[model samples]
Target: MTSRSHSLRDAIEEQIAVGELRPGQHLDETELATRFGVSRTPIREALIQLASMGLVVIRPRRGAVVAEIAPQQLVEMFEVMAELEAMCGRLAARRMFTEEHAQLQAAHDACREAREAVDSDEYYYRNEAFHEQIYAGSHNAFLAEQARNLHRRLRPYRRLQLRVRDRVATSFSEHQEIVDAIVAGDGERTAALLRDHIMIQGQRFADLIASLAHLSNKAA
Candidate 1:
């Protein structure tokens, strides 16, 4: 992507994050171009990127709109994602090579840097790389592929999880535990930690649902 498209993409994502562009809200290329002082071409490219990330839905005739997921469906997807990630952690603990372990540590360090900077958006991107390292470390091609597919589908919702109050710090601490377990070659401990790490629980789940509801209402 060109610099224009990259900037436009970040602009649009920020708009969505701030509820300026709400779920199910139609995106007009011409209007976005006008608002951003860019042409339709870059706007279109940015929208495509958003669609690929599951942030927006692109229809044949209806154009692009912010993607919407029912709360129950969102929970279900997260549950599945949790299981997939747990599996990756388990396999990674058993199968990761020396070089892969080093890479995973590097990703974790990058996440720590993002956390130190208190940049949730930066942490969000780095968190993805951190998980990708786990998937690759799993050393199971089919499992990694399946995990990646679900991971992509849950990308937007996962990103929203970070928006919860103080979630970044808590998540980083959990990541540290997970990394320690993996490095210690404790497959069971790693799997259990990872399962809890990604699985939204009592209050967190409630907060996530409320946040999603707020976004949906604002969009409506």
Candidate 2:
């Protein structure tokens, strides 16, 4: 893809992740092109990319619109994601090198700073980096790739979850435990922590649904 297309994809993806672009909202290529000062080609390309990532849907005649995932489907996806992350953490605990552990600590520290600043966007970015370190540290190329693909697919929902009250702070605290487990080379503990960290359940699941409903109402 051209630089323009790549930038356009990122821009659209961010908007969707941040809830500025609501699920099921139409993505008019011409409007996007005008808004971004680009041609329809790039906008089309961007939407196509988003579709492949499960963030958008291209209808037969309705053109492109943001993808609408059912609540149960979302839950199912998270369940699978939690398992994938747990496996990564388990392997990472046993296989990560000394330098990799240092890098993970650095990422965790960055997340701490973002949490202290109470900047959800910054924390979200750092949080992604922190998890990515574990994925890479797993030393399983295929598993890492699978985790990454699912991570990308769920990016929007994950970002939205941080908007819930006190979630960012709680998430950082959980990360502390996760980091401690991994650094201690406790594979089972790391796996359990990672699974719980990635799973959306109970109040968090309720909050996510509420947030999605609010966004849907606004779109309506």
Candidate 3:
């Protein structure tokens, strides 16, 4: 991707992730081009890229809009994400090198700082870094690529999950447990923790939905 298209993609994705661009919300090519000070060509390219990433939809006659995932689809996506994360954790626990472990530790420390400051956005980015480190530590390049692709697709929903009451602190604690298990080379324990960490079922799912609704209301 060209630098302009890449930046435009990032900007649009950020808006969607933060709920500024609601699901099914229309994305006017000309408006976005004007807003971003770029030509319609780059905007169209960015929308096409986002569509491939499952973050946007391109209809034959209606143009592009943010992707609207159904609740069932959301559950299914999270289910798959949980398993992928578990697989990564398992491999990472066994295959992680000394330097990778050190990097994971540092990322964990940053998460702790974000939690201490009660900074959900900071925690969100650090949390992403922490998980990406685990994916990299897995040492299976193909598996890591698949896992990262799914991670990107679920980025918005996962980020919204952090907005649930007290979830940031709870997530940080879980990260601590995961870090300890990985450092001890306990593959099974790390895998189990990772699965639980990403799977938002029952009350957790309800809570995530509620948080998203609250954010949507505010955005409106």
**Root-mean-square deviation (CA) per prediction:** 3.7, 1.3, 1.1
lDDT of 2 by residue, 154-190 (tens): 8889998998899999999999999899989999999
Q: Give the TM-score of candidate 3.
A: 0.97
Q: Candidate 1's C-alpha lDDT? A: 0.87
TM-score of 1: 0.77
lDDT of 1 at 44: 94
> Model 3 over residues 83-175: C-alpha lDDT tens digits?
999999999999999989999999999999999999988899999999999999999998899899899888889988998889999999999
Best by TM-score: 3
Q: Tens digit of lDDT per residue, candidate 1, span 5-57?
A: 98998889867765577777899999999998989999999999988878789
Q: Tell me which of candidates 1 and 3 scores higher on TM-score.
A: 3
Give per-candidate clash totals: 0, 0, 0
Better of 1 and 2 by TM-score: 2
